[model samples]
Target: MESISPLQFLKDKSILVIGATGFLGKVFAGKILRIQPNVKKLYLVVRAADAKSAMKQILDEVYVSTS
Candidate 1:
């Protein structure tokens, strides 16, 4: 029997994330980053009226703080 580590597979790999503002998407993206901080690139596709709003959504909705 053999087991491949998911983190190892994602390390240094580029990932594209869509609907980053959504619940599942945000959680998935956050998990990926937390698990594999060394990922080559994390491309996020967000829908917004403008770049500013998109940034706000990502910061406020996607990324949150416990403190």
Candidate 2:
């Protein structure tokens, strides 16, 4: 068995992040995007049960900082 960095795992792969609207979740999402912008796309889980809010979170936190 060997260890793999998250960036490596996410390289050219689609990532689905559950509970990614919280404090820690946001951090993980940020790291993935910051290191691997070309990792495909991110699917963030949220309690709002709608794409609008979920998209907002991704845009506000994950995408904003990187840009």
Candidate 3:
């Protein structure tokens, strides 16, 4: 018998994460990225002035610092 990894369920799938800048959200996002770097897509919902600003904030505050 072989064991199946739950992470395999996320393969090639797109994930949408709300509140991705918050503590739990950031942890969740980091875990997902770390485990499944080849996911189809990741959409992070964040609050900001515009789309560009939201992306920048997430990158600078969450992704960059964590990485």
Candidate 4:
């Protein structure tokens, strides 16, 4: 018998996450990226003045702190 890791399911998959700036959403995003580094993509939908600001916020608040 062999055991399969649940993380395997996420490999090479695209994920769209809304409200990623919130507490639980941030936790979920961090965990997914940390556990499955090979995930195809992570689309974080955030509310901001513009696309640039959204990207900056995600980079600073999520990726920077988590990584």
Candidate 5:
């Protein structure tokens, strides 16, 4: 059997990620972003009080992992 990388599992797909702002989810998302920069897009599900806040949380998670 061939081993598939996590990045391969996400190629050319519109991935809908729930809990992307959470700890585990953020790490998973960060790995994808770092390895698969050409992914279609990153859809994040957040439950903050407002859309701005939710988006901020997602962005913070992803960008923080970059450093």
Candidate 6:
């Protein structure tokens, strides 16, 4: 057995995160990036007025102050 690197696993990978605008999802998504910034893509699913607003919500609420 061997230990696998989180970064290695995430590289060039696309992630679909539901409720990413919420607390837990935010933490998870943030940690993923913090641990592996080279992830190919991060797809976040949230409820908002539109695509623009959904992105805004995710940006404004999630992945902030995660250090």
Q: What is the C-alpha lDDT of each candidate?
A: 0.85, 0.77, 0.87, 0.87, 0.77, 0.82
What is residue 67's positional error in candidate 1, in angstroms? 9.0
Q: TM-score of each candidate?
A: 0.83, 0.64, 0.81, 0.82, 0.72, 0.76
Tens digit per residue, CA lDDT, model 6, 1-67: 8988877878999999998877788888889888888888998889888888877776678845454
Which of the two, 1 or 4, has more TM-score?
A: 1
Q: lDDT score of model 2?
A: 0.77
lDDT of 2 by residue, 1-67 (tens): 9999876787889888887767877788888877888887777777666878878877777566545
Give the TM-score (vs. native) of candidate 2: 0.64
Better of 1 and 2 by lDDT: 1
Instruction: For candidate 5, write residues 4-54 as lDDT tens digits.
Output: 987787787787778877787778777777788878977878889998887
Considering lDDT, which of the candidate structures 1 and 4 is the better prediction for this target? 4
lDDT of 4 by residue, 1-67 (tens): 8886869889989999999887877899999988999999998889999999998989888786567
The residue-level lDDT of candidate 5 at 4 comes to 90
Ranking by TM-score: 1, 4, 3, 6, 5, 2
Q: Considering lDDT, which of the candidate structures 2 and 4 is the better prediction for this target?
A: 4
Ranking by lDDT: 4, 3, 1, 6, 5, 2
Clashes of each: 0, 0, 0, 0, 0, 0
Of 1 and 3, the candidate ranking higher by lDDT: 3
User: Against the true structure, what is every candidate's RMSD?
Assistant: 2.4, 2.9, 2.4, 2.4, 2.5, 2.2
TM-score of 1: 0.83
Which segments of model 6 are wrong by more than 4 Å? 1-3
Once model 4 is optimally superposed onto the true structure by TM-score, how far is the C-alpha of residue 2 displaced, in angstroms?
Answer: 12
Question: Local error of candidate 1 at 29, Å?
Answer: 0.8
Instruction: Pick the lDDT winner.
Output: 4
